[model samples]
Target: MSDEQGFSPRERRASFTLAGIFGMRMLGLFMIMPVFALYGQDLIGFSPLWVGIVIGVYGLTQAILQIPVGWLSDRIGRKPVIYAGLALFALGSVVAALSDSVYGVAIGRVLQGSGAIAGAILALAADITREENRTKAMAIIGVCIGISFAIAMVLGPVLAAFIGLSGVFWTTALLALVGILMVRFMLPEQAHRGQIRDVTAAPELFGRLLKDRQLLRLDFGIMLLHLTLTAVFVAFPLTLLDAGLVAEHHWWLYLPTLLLSFVLIVPFLILGARRNMNKQLFQASILVMMAALLLMAAGQGQLWLLALAMMLYFTAFNFMEASLPAFLSMLAPAGAKGTAMGIYSTSQFFGAFLGGVLGGLLYQQLGGGGVFVLVAVCMAFWFWLATGMTNVSKVRSHILSIGVNIENKDQREQLLQRLMALPGVHEALIIPEEGAAYLKVDGNIFELDQARRLINL
Candidate 1:
């Protein structure tokens, strides 16, 4: 049996394979961000508005389907949902690949969004790993995604330079196919076990989680983060052009900025973690985000200044992108991570869609500088919200199977009491039908074996 000592072999397989799947899928999506408008100009009925729609329509469908699809996965199965989602993504890529009109590509983008597998993919990652090591599994996937996004931003224009827009779509289609193959062959077979509440969304819990001010603030922050990201991608290229940097050489800027951001963020993250400065680090990152935006606005037509601002922007972006979910997970009630994440994902996509709209509108009306300044306003609001939020540091969640021996309500109550009485346990929820106990614990002091013994499993 797998214990907390390390990742079992299956966990290793699941983590790397799932990370590959997510990385490929994200690479496909992000590859278009930096080059879409430039390439869309070649299509029939090309216009700035159409480019924005095509870029963001994917988010629209994704936001609508994320929660529902996650809910569906609980009833059906993870593999099936993942397989179906990949197929839709591939089909969308094909549709876009064959399109000569911007409208057709917009349709393809919408189809791409229909493949909402994030919740399922995350749930699967959680299911395969031991609770103690689950974050490491997730971190693997997160690293893959961050790397993919950076590569895609740098690679997209280079690919378009050689292959054109249609070819990029075909490449994305191939990527989706690769993901499908990995799911079919590379993924480990999940063992039959009780429903994992910590990792799986509970529809019954949505009403309460939705009303939580703390969680809502996090959701709004992610939404703003993505909204600014999409908006920046939409508008910043024009900023580069106005600064005398040609389109092709833009990758030079992105490559260095992204690489430097990744390198610089490590020390910051280490300091944040080691000093137990979650809230401070988080709020400071938000401030950096706002500063980056304002700097972009002020640096109009200044290439060197804009490049510096981008470095700051991405450093904070990368940090917040990874840290927000960790904070949410820490703050989420035992058994509620999945639902919180589901809602968080929905907000993220919706923000993307909104960003596209806003980017297009602002660029047309007030130009790239205006987009950055206005987005900075939103970031300022998020920073304020972050200041008011509470941080749950050094806490980890665990879902333990309490074997089906309880015969009555009194026995269940007694069991829950004992689990709660254990030192360093902050939250406990026992679901008898599921034969599981969900717990949030102070990792420095909590003993998993003690809980295991108390559960008599």
Candidate 2:
């Protein structure tokens, strides 16, 4: 049943099913982005600030609970936590669907975020896939997320026009229910849990990762990226409206811009990955975003200009979204990747919340121009911080099992030194508690069979 890539049928099923479930959940979350500002204004107590709150409150809840929820999954079980999270999401969607006031909708958004199942779902995915195939499984999930975002952007306005905002909430609720059912029936139950050191966050490593300036900078970068993204959406729809684009026709702008931006980002991605220009490409992408924000602030009431700005913004956004994680993976300490990523994810959600609140406050006090200016300022700061980031080496992470009998500290250190002496090995750590050796290696020169034989000894 094994494929050429060594993935068994069950692993393949888990990967695709889990990816679909993640996609469905994200689709529900993103479907509200395009039309929330326009439609939210109709609710009671609908200030610009509340509109931003309603749009972003979910992130606040998500930020607070994602890590704890993952911890809970480890203690009880993955499926149970996933079920509870999805149920919470569905309940929140129903609440939003029934709300007549902005505050009510904000409450629902908070509940929606309380689901916070991302970590748990990823843990479950790790539990099921082989270590070597884990990256491929995660890539499948990543692709699903990208596709869901693209589809949601195009579909949000169209769905809003057809069914109204409440109906969109209802649809989201239904999607969450579907996700719950999939978890119940479709995913294979994990038998024995492996030490997924790379993917599952370890709480003990938080302080170390937080203090590492390199990882902290990357964390801040993700935060600022999502913050700017949310803040822009808070104002962008209104900008389109002022330029005479109707709510129903908004997709006309998003569809073409998104398509063109995807096309435009390919060259940068290629150069960054193929030519080892990631650092240069990363900095340039941020600069592009800053320029786009500046254009947005200055080009009020100009439809064509706004569209061009959006194209620039999305091109950079897409590139950064893809690149940041790769950078994080490369920069994370050998045993602390999960904790580093967990913090990064938390920062991202917090940024979304801050962006919503800041965007709303600025729009209310200083108008849409203020929102753009604020985002531009944040982007500039991000650019400054990014300049100090070191380029990570092109090393890949690998994990090998060590027998539990090798418990002595001297023996462990001796094994670690031997592993590090391998041709392609850059770093190796043998954790006696986990009975595994985590490695960073240049794959081109790393002799896998030789490493395996050494570990078995």
Q: Judged by lDDT, which candidate is best?
A: 2
| Tens digits of per-residue lDDT for model 2, 1-457 | 7965688999999999999989999899888888899887778899888878877889999999988887777778788888999999999999999999998888988999999998888888988887778889988998899889888988899999999999999999999999988988999877535335676688788888889999999999999999998889889999999989999999999999999999999898888877788888899999999999999999899999999999999999999998888889888878777778889999989998998898889999988899998899999999999999897657688777788536798888888888999999888877776678888888678987798888777
lDDT of 2: 0.88
In order, candidate lDDTs are 0.87, 0.88
In candidate 1, what residue range of length 10 has the lowest lDDT sum? 191-200
State the TM-score for model 2: 0.96
TM-score of each: 0.96, 0.96
Q: What is the lDDT of residue 454 in candidate 2?
A: 87
Q: What is the lDDT of residue 334 in candidate 2?
A: 84
* Candidate 1 Cα errors over 4 Å, as ranges: 1-4, 191-195
How many steric clashes between backbone atoms does each model show?
0, 0
